[model samples]
Target chain A: MMDLTQPQWVKHVVFHPFEGFEDLRWKKGGTLKYTAVIIVALFFALIAFDRWCGFQFRPLPDAMFSVVPYIMKSVVYFFAWVLGNWAICTLLDGEGTMKNIAIYSSYALIPYIVEVYIQVFLSHILVRAEGVFFSTVYYVGIIWTVLLLFNAIKAVHQYSFTKTVVAIILTIAAMLVILFLAVLFLSLFQKVYVFFYSLYTEILYRLRV
Target chain B: MKNKSRRLLKQCAAAGLVCLLSFSAVSLPVSADEPYDVYNYNYLGEAVPSQAGYLAERSVSGLDLGTTALNAPSDLFKDKDDFFYLVDSGNNRILKIDSDFTQIVQEYKSFKMEDGSETTLKNPKGVFVSPDTGLMYIADNENARALIVNPDGTVFREITKPASTVYDQQLTFLPQKILCDNAGNVYIVLNNTTKGSAMFNADGEFIGYYGANSVAPTAEVIANHFWNAIASEDEKKYRSRSTPTAFDNFDIDTVKGFIYTSTSSGSTDTDIIKKVNPEGYNLFDYMSGYTWGDLFSTWYSGTSYKTKIVDVDIGDDGSINCLDSTTGRVFQYDKEADLLFIMGATGDQVGAFSQGNVTALETKGENCENIYVLDAGKGTVTVFGQTVFGEIVHEATALYNGGYYEEALGPWLEVLKRDGNYRRAYLGISSAYYNMGRYKESMEYAKKADASARYNRAFERYRSQWLREHLTQLLIGIVLIVIGIRLLKYVIRKQKNKKKHSEPAASGSGT
Candidate 1:
C-alpha cells in the first residue's frame, strides 16, 4: 500500500514538471508583455527552422514553388499564429508575469515541435513513395490532430494527466470537431473572397486600366 | 500643490463611482421586490406581504392549525361531525380539525383502511367527503386502492376493480384519486379511467358506471357481449383504437352541482394536462394551443372578476381557486392583481400536494376565505390565509418544494456564479429558460437536467425502460458486426497459413 502520509511523489511527478525553471521565472510585473515576447521569439524560431529545412526540398525555384508545399507551410504558419495568440492572451491575462506566461507558452509549444519532428522523419522516408500524396495527407492529418489535442488541453484544465493522456489517444475526436469548424469557416471565407474578387476583376476589365 | 490636490479629488470621485456601481450590482437581488407588479406573486422567498391592491385582511380568525401546512392540501373532506379533514399529505397523516380549524380535534394515520383495518398506506393521494351522508373517502395510493371511512374511524368499504376484469393476468389498474358527490355516488379516478358507482341513499351500493367507458376494455366488451352476427363482423372490422382518457384526478362540488377532473395524455416524448367538467361537458387541454374562443366562453364571469381555469375548485360561496401547476407554478387568478399569486417554488411537489405531488385543492369557507394545501411530502396540512397585500406563503411546503427549483433564474444563476456544480439549479434555470422561449438556452439547461436526472433511480429506470431497450439492440448489432469482421479475418489468415504449410511439405517430399 502507498503511504498516505507522504504524497511527495505526486507533487514531484505532476507539479514540478510544470514548475518554473531558472530562466522561466516571472520576468516583470507585466505577464502579458512577457508572453508576447516569448511567442514572438517562438514564431521567429519556427520560421528559421522552416527556412533551414526549406533548403532540402528546394521546390524548383522556377515554378513558384509547387502550390502544395507553399500551401502546407502557410497552413502550419497560420496554426502557429493561432496557438501563440490564444496562449499568450489566456495565460498572461491575470496573475501571470511576462516570464511566467512565456513558460506556459513554451510548454504548450512542446507538442507542436514534437509533431514537426515526426512530420520531418515521415517526409524523409515517404518523399520517394509512388503516391506522395497519401504520405503527405497522412502526416498532415497527424500534425493537425496533435495541434488540436494540445489546444483543447490548454483550453480545459479540469482533467488529470491520465485523462489528458487518454484524450491524446482519442486525438481524432478533438481533431474532428476543430477541423470541422475550421473547414466550415475557411469554405465560407473562400466563397466570399471569390465573389468579391470576381467583381473586382470584372470592374478592372471594364475600366481596361 | 494645488494641481496635485485637484487631481487627488478627481481620483477620489472616480473611486467612489466605482464603489457605487459595484454595490448596486451586489444589491440587485435584495432590491428585486421593489419593482414587483401588483399581479406578481413571489412566494418562494421568505414570506413577505403581497404587493398592493389584493387582500385587505391578512389574518383569518379562529382557525389556527398552528405551524400547519395546509397551503394546498392534495385532498379536503368534511365529515359527519362537521370536522374538515385535511390530508396533511406532507406529514403522511390526515389532520382532522373542526370547520373553523380552531382546533385539531382528531388525527388519523393514512394507513388505517376503510374498514378501520391496519394496512400501510404508501401515500395518501386524495381526500373526499360525501355530501349525501358525510362519509370520508381517502385514496391510499401505496396500497393502490381507495378506502371509505366513517367519522368514528370505521372502514365502511374498500373499493377495488371487479375480479372478472383481472382474468388471464392482463390487468393494469392503478387508482390515483377518488371523489364523492351529493347523490351518494362515489367516483374513483384511475390512471386512465373514471370508474364509479352510484350509492343508494347513505348506503354504499354498486349502482352503475359513470362518465366514459374504459380505453382497453371497449374491444373486449364488444367481443364478449355482441353476438356472432353481421353486426359482430362489422364491429370487429371497424374496431377503433381511440386514445385513452386523460384524467389525472377528480373533484366534486356538491353546492355548485359539478364534477372536476384533471386528465393528462402523452408519454415521456409528449405530455398534456386538461381540466374537465362533467355538467358543462367542457375540457381545457393546454397542449391544443390557445383557443381564445373557448377561453372567453368557458370562463366563470363574476361582476368584477373572471377566471379561466385549468384546475379549480368551487369554494363554499361558489368562488373558484384554480391551479396552474404546469410550468411549476400555481397562479391564483383574481380581480385584484396582488391576489393572483404564484406558488410551488419547487417543481417536483405541486398542485394540491399528495406526498410531494399536489393531488387536489379546495377552499375552506364561503368567501374563498382560506386555501388549504395538502402536501404529501411532509405529510402535513398547510393553511394559508389571504394576506393584507394578498401574498400567501406556506413555510414548510416551500422548503420541500424549493429543492426542485427556485422561483426564478436569479437565485439559481447567483449560485452558478459562485459554484457551477450545483446541478439542480442548472435544471431549474433551464426550465425557466424554456418557459421564456429561449430554446437554445433550454437545450443547455436540458443537458444539466439530463445529468442530474440520471442520478435519480426512478428517473433512470424510466429512461432505461423508454429508451434503452431500443438502443441496446442497435448496440448489439454493432458489436456483432465487429465480431464478424474479426472472425472472417482470422479464418482467412488460417487458410493462408495452411496452404503454405502444405506446399512446403509437398516440396520436401518431392526432393
Candidate 2:
C-alpha cells in the first residue's frame, strides 16, 4: 500500500529491478519532478567524478579544466537516449508514453550517481595499487544501471526480454543516424551562410567604392 | 695651400686602411676575445638564460693553423691524446690540431695505399679515431668509400660497395658518417640506403644492414594494411610500397658500444633518434612512449614542428646530446633518456648559431666539462664550458642516475637556489626526500615537478600513516554510527506501530 508516486519508490525500483519497474508502470510510481532531479544530480555527479577524483583514477589531461564535455556526456546523452528509445518504441508497439519512458530511464540512473559519489570520496583515501577495488565498484554500478534500464524498458513497453534487447539495439542505431543527419545539416547551413555573407560583402565593397 | 691639401689626403688614406683592417677582423666570424652567453632550459621547458652553464670560451676556425680557413669543417673528433681532428671536407683534408686548438699537430691530405699509391680524400664528411687500435676511420663520402687509415697515415683497409648478396647492388653506397665499435665492427651511415647503416666486420667484409628504421604507424599505413588484406595479388603488386627512413648520422658509445643514430628528416616522427645495441636492435624503443625530441616547436603557431635531429653524441657520463637542425637547438638527455637541458638557438648571439648547420658535437674533459659544437656555415667550432649552476645540475643528475638519491639532495637544493623553474631539480629533490622518508615534503616537490607517479607514491605513504594514526578513532566512530542507525530504526518502527493501531481504531469508529 505504499505511495507509488513518492520519491522513495526510486530506491525500491533500483533494488527490485524485476518487480519494482512493473509496479511503477502499472501504478504510476515515478514522478517527473523526482526524475528530473535525479538526472540533474547525475550531471553534477559526473562533473565531481571527473574534477575531484584521485589523480590516479582521473585519466583526463590535468592541464585542461573544462566541464562542458562532462555536461554534454551526461545531460545531452541521457536525453538523446530517451528520445532515441521513444522513437524506436513507437514502431515496436510499446505501451509506454514518451514522458513515462524518459522518467523511467532517468530513474534507472540512480545507481550510477550513488556509485560516482562514493568513488569520488574513495579516490582521496585509496592509492594507485588499490585502484582495482574502486574500478570494481565503478563497473558494478554501471552494470546495475544497465540492468535497471533493461527492466524499465521491458516493463514500460510490456515486451519480452529478447524484444526489449532488439528495441535497445535499434534505438542505438537510430541515435547514430540522427547524429549523422545533425552534422550534415550543420555543415550545409554553414556553406549557405558563407555564400550569403560573401554576397553581402561584395555589395558593401561596391557601395563604399 | 697645396701642402695642406696633400697632408689631408694622407690622413684620409691612413683612416681608410684602419677601417678596412678592422672590418676584415670582424668579418672572420671567429672571435676569441668577445665573451658569449650559454643558456639551458628550466623545469617549465622554457629556454632561460642561466649563469652556471656553458659560456662560449673560443670558436676555433682552424685559420691560425694556416689551413684554407677550414672550408666547411664537417666533423670534429678528439683523440685519446687530446688531439682534435677537424674534417675539413671542402678542402678534402683532415686537420689534426692540439687539444687547446691553437696548434696543428698533423694534417692528413692523402694516405698511402697498400700498393704504395697516394689516394687523396674527396669531400670526406665524418672521422673517428679508434682508441683500442689507434687507427682513423674516415667517411670518404663523395668517393663512396670508407678509409680505415693506420696511425702512420697508411690506408689499412678500404670499404667500398659491398658485393654481398644481401647488399642491394642497385643502392648506392655513399658513406656520409662512420664509426667503429670496440669489436672492430664498422657501421657506416649511407646517404641513399634506408635499410639502416651498412655493417662491416674487421676484415672490411660487408656483413649485412643493421638497425633498420621501423615504419611509423600512420593513418595511411593502417589504411594500406586494411586494403592489402582484402585486395587481390595483382592489385597488391600495384600498391605503393612503404620504405623505412634512412639514418642521417650516428655515433658509437665507447664504453657500452651502443651505436646511436639520428635521422634529420622533418617528414616522419618515428625513429628520429635511436640507440642500437650490438645485436642490431633499437634498445631505446622501450622508452614507454617517451618522444625523443621537442614535442612541439615554440616558434610555430597552431601547428607542431617536428625535430630534425641531425646528429647525436653520447656524453662522457652517458648523456645523449641530440642536435636538432630544424630549431638549431641541442637537447641533452641523461642515460635513461630524461631530458636534462635544451641548449643552443638559431640567432647571432654567443649561445646561438647563425643560419649555419650544426654538423657535429663533441664533449671533452673527464665529466664532459666542455661541449664543442661545429658549425658548418660559419666554418667554426664553438666551445661551451660548464658554469657553476650547470655543474651543480650535472652533479645532481649524475648522483640521481647512479641511484644515490639521498646524496644528490644537497646539489639538487643548490640547483633550485639558482633556477627555481628547474623541473629536474624539483624531481631530484622529491626523489631524495622520498628516499629519506619525508613523504609530505616529497609530495609537495613532486606536485611542483608535475611528477604524478612520485606524488602518488608519497600520497599513498602519507594516507596510510594518517589512517594508522587515527584507526582507533575511526573504528569508534563507525561503531557509534551503527548504534545510532539501529536506535533510530527501532524508534521509527515503534512510532509506526502506534500510528497503525490508532489509524485502524479511528477507521473502525468512522465506519
DockQ score of each predicted structure, in the order shown: 0.01, 0.24
Model 2 per-residue lDDT at A139: 100
Alpha carbon lDDT at B102, candidate 2: 76
Per-model TM against the reference: 0.36, 0.79
| TM-score top scorer | 2
- Report iRMS values in order: 29.8, 5.8
- Native-structure RMSD, model 1: 28.6
| Model 2, span B84-178: residue lDDT tens | 88899999999888887777889999999999999999999999999899999999999989999999999999999998899888888788888
Residue ranges of candidate 1 with Cα displaced over 4 Å: A1-209, B1-83, B88-93, B98-103, B109-123, B142-145, B163-174, B192-209, B212-240, B264-280, B283-312, B324-328, B333-341, B347-360, B378-382, B389-511
lDDT of 1 at B162: 41
Top model number, lDDT: 2
Model 1 Cα lDDT, one tens digit per residue, B1-511: 9999999999999999999999987854522322232223222222333333122122221234654544334566655445777665445567777876567777777444544457645467677777666667777766666678876777777765544422222444455567776666666665544343222223544444444423444555456444434356567666543444555654565665566544332221111222334533434332332211012112235531222223455555433455433222244432111123444323332222322244445566444556655433444444555543231222211221344333556655654554343343465576555555454465456555443221232223333444555787878899999999999999999988898787876533421
